[model samples]
Target: MDTHTAATRYIGPTGMDPIFNRIANWLPKLGIDVAGGRLLAVRGRKSGEWRTTLVNVLTTDDGNRYLVAPRGHTQWVRNLRVAGAGEIRLGRKVEAFTATEVADADKIPVLRAYLDRWGWEVGRFFEGVTQDATDAELADIAPGFPVFRLA
Candidate 1:
């Protein structure tokens, strides 16, 4: 299944996505870091204006940084697809990078590592899969979770 089809079939935004996004967006503006979270700004594919959201930035053991869409194909994910690049800001510090979507097949380790660090906050979105889940298990849900590598 393609990413869009797979995403629509699984999870979308939750009731709390907006509530938490608002709070998360506010924190970084005040110089508060919520577990490595930052404000991601990408230009809207249609509107051409920058859209912002609070996102969890995951850094793996190999020093690569990633952004995972635990909420499936969200607006930010769709926007990033068109923009191809964006900025992540924490307080006044902003880091800009090009974004490359990680294929569903290659998302295993990235998803696992993301779960390991942010599972306490986002585990429920994975439908009971944990960081300890086997490769096969991660693969089953891979299509539903869109991942990106920041360059």
Candidate 2:
């Protein structure tokens, strides 16, 4: 996650990515759980229609749950800000909840935990930070990663 890599790696999903997400969204609907992945259905800010995407759920050590957007300023993030609440669906099971945006200063531990769990998938976005990274190091890159405290 060098500066150059971090600077360039987070281009957001493009090209075939949406197609892949559409397919991934199906597995959860089909009753197949993929690494705690779920279909996150949130109301679109402008369209007022449900926008669905695949997201991996993170359960912290304190029994709290979270959703981290490694890609900064993404559509889902923007929609969540307006909608305030959303649903996470896994097959027939769905959990409806509210989301609180975690402040950048408070995201170090959450970001660290996220990297520990899914860094292999999202590490590129962190600018080279890792789970073993120092608190100062993680804090330096925290703002780029948006975290939601779910309840």
Candidate 3:
């Protein structure tokens, strides 16, 4: 199997850090995801619980907000699928939004932008790995990666 596929297979589905709660609490106060982005708080699909995560606020040329899941098929992605739709808190305002799973073909550029924004860590992670993951490969791993927008 290709490196990207292999990595996804190995990671499988895992739980998130407890600290995510702390980050979620502070994100709104700090006005995260507001001007153009916001924090999405969703319920776990199987676990049926709350999970809040910080994600980049991506605005397409047409004026829609999207949250890209670069980590592939992580817990957040699964939770988003289960929750279907959730809430976004921006500054003092909170709004409900629907989560949609975008296909790889349509999401590659956005994924590339996300990796670029997180270059330092992403670069370091792939530093020693012989099988460097291409943007397309990364997208393929979790094809159903979630993208959230205002509902």
Query: Comparing 1 and 2 by TM-score, which wins?
Result: 1
On a 0 to 100 scale, what is the lDDT of residue 63 in model 2? 97
How far is 59's C-alpha from truth in model 3 (Å)? Answer: 0.9
Deviation in Å, model 3, residue 68 alpha carbon: 1.1
lDDT head-to-head 1 vs 3, winner = 1
TM-scores for candidates 1 onward, in order: 0.91, 0.88, 0.62
Tens digits of lDDT, candidate 3, 91-135: 777777886766556766655554555544333333322124575
Clashing residue pairs in candidate 3 are 33-37, 33-38, 34-37
lDDT of 2: 0.84
Q: Return the clash pairs for model 1, or none.
A: none
Q: Arrange candidates by TM-score, highest first: which order? A: 1, 2, 3
Clashes of 2: 2
Residues 1-151 of candidate 1 have per-residue lDDT tens digits of 4556676744655688768767778998787997888899999999999898888999888899999998788889999999999999888988999999999899999999999999999898887999999999898889889899999
> Against the hidden true structure, what lDDT does model 1 obtain?
0.88
Winner by TM-score: 1
Estimate every model's Cα lDDT from 0 to 1. 0.88, 0.84, 0.58
Best by lDDT, which number? 1
